[model samples]
Target: MRIIAHRGASHAEPENTAAAFDAALVEGADGIELDLQLSRDGEVVVFHDATLARLGLRRARIRDHDWSDLAGLDVGRWFAGQATPHRMLRLTDVLAGWGGRTHLYLEIKHAEGRRGRDRHRELAERTAEAVRAAGLIDQVSILSFHEAALEAVHALVPTLALVRNVQRVGLLTRAAQQRAGLSALCVAVDRFGAAQRARLAALERPVYVYTCDTPAQFRRACDLDATAVISNGPAAARRWFAGQTSA
Candidate 1:
């Protein structure tokens, strides 16, 4: 199974930063997953939250600030044992730095309090443009919890891969996935099991479980025959996978 770094080896480095992405590649992850949010100036920034509270900065909506304003924030200092400061990264920067080195699972984060379908469509368009500009469309797969976002992306880039990130496996989720022509299904680790795996397998789409950080969850992912396992501890997951292969 493929091992994808959730937020780019986030357990070792600041989530969604360049350092985390680079570290994931060094640790032998098959791919890196990162979140994307649009700034006030319409720049697609690589970040996880709509707010900066977790990074120890004054709580401010990411969409309310321009990329320039958000860029200077020190995001890494809050992590335990991390002395060096790390700035927020733009999607363009990440694409330039590690575009072709590994597959990208780019998730479009739904902006809180944002209404209407236009916003999601615009995000999909901008993200698609960035991927095309980097010439890494083939290596990038777009994922989102909002079906509208995936639909917009599919309409914009028919050939680009799309993954539906669902919290549960149900008829509604399955119908949406089928309608969107999604390339994969990313479900929460807790929601996945033998029956769910078999059902998804029958659909012929790869199942990628998310945010698995512990050894037992990694092993459970393997037992389910997941097509890929997304985890914060990419280094540990890589080590485990290597051991399994050699065993």
Candidate 2:
């Protein structure tokens, strides 16, 4: 199974920061997973939450401000470390810097309760441009829980690999796979059962699990033949997987 760093070794560094991603690479993670949101000026920035309040800064919406404004905020204080202050990262920076070295899983955050046809399209256009500019269009796979957002991304870059991220396993997932032309399934490892694993296996596509920080969860992912295991601690997962492979 592949070990993907969730938010770039978040257990060690602030989530979604360049330093965190660099640490993940230094620790030899197989993949790096991150979330994307569009700024006011249509820049695709890598960040998890919509607000900056959790980072001990003002409660400002990332989408409401441009990248220049958001970049000035300290995004690292939310983590346990006292010395680290995270700078907002651009999606283009990650692709150009780390695309060839590690697998990139881009999760597009949906603008919930907001209605506009072009909003998703704008995000998709910026994401596509960045991926293409960095020559990572083939290497990176874009994913989203919202089907509409995924559709917008697919329209922008049809050849880009897409994954359907869902909470539960059911017809919705199956339908998403069919409708989105998704190449992989990313699910919560605990929600996957024998039947679901078998079903996904039969489809001949990869199945990935998210936020697997424990050894037992890693074992379950291995047993289920998961293609990728996303976790906050990539080093721990790497050691466990290496041991499994050697055993």
Model 1, 1-247: lDDT tens digits are 7889999888888888888988898888999999998888888988888788887656688878998898888878777788788998888888888888889989998866645356567788899888887888899999998887888787777778998887876642554445656888787787776666566666777778887888778877876677889999887887887898899
The digit string of per-residue lDDT tens for model 2 on 183-236 reads: 887878788756566776777778888879888888778766888889999989
TM-score of each: 0.93, 0.91
Supply every candidate's count of residue pairs whose N, Cα or C atoms clash at under 3 angstroms. 0, 0
**Clashing residue pairs, candidate 1?**
none
Candidate 2, residue 51: lDDT: 72
Q: For this target, which candidate reaches the highest lDDT against the unseen true structure? A: 1
> What are the runs in model 1 whose C-alpha is more than 4 Å off?
114-116, 171-176
